[model samples]
Target: MDIKKIAVIAGDVIGPEVVSEGVKVMKKAAEIDGRISFEFTYFPWGCEFYLEQGKMMDEDGVCPA
Candidate 1:
């Protein structure tokens, strides 16, 4: 059986905290199943990044995966 991949894109601020909890839950589930697996990815792009970049993610027009 092949394990599925899980991609999570979270903005800055509370986004990281929230996503961290979610990843913990998924990891627990994978352990219980003893087969399923997941790959979690968090992207920190929010107000701070926008301020530095001089634009919101939308303004940058970078497409999200």
Candidate 2:
């Protein structure tokens, strides 16, 4: 089995929408190919988050600390 890992950070504005569409397409591809799969990890850190948290993200935001 071949699996690919993807990290997604929906920053703001069209970022989420674009990522959503990409994920949908990738999922379809994976579904069609049994040997191929994807593992998606989402990180919530962006401009909108900064407005509320006063920072774009924590020091280890990417690593989820």
TM-scores of all models?
Answer: 0.62, 0.76
Task: Please report the candidate that would top lDDT against the real structure.
Answer: 2
The residue ranges of model 1 lying beyond 4 angstroms of the native Cα positions read: 12-14, 55-65
In the range 1-65, model 2's lDDT, one tens digit per residue, is 89998888876776889989999999999999889999998888888788889998877765632
* Reference-based lDDT, residue 34, model 2: 88
lDDT (0 to 1) per candidate: 0.71, 0.85
Query: RMSD of each candidate?
Result: 3.5, 2.9
Give one digit per residue, the lDDT tens place, for model 1 in 12-50: 655777988888998998998887888765454678867
**Pairs of colliding residues, candidate 1:** none
Q: How many residue pairs clash in each candidate?
A: 0, 0
Candidate that would win on TM-score:
2
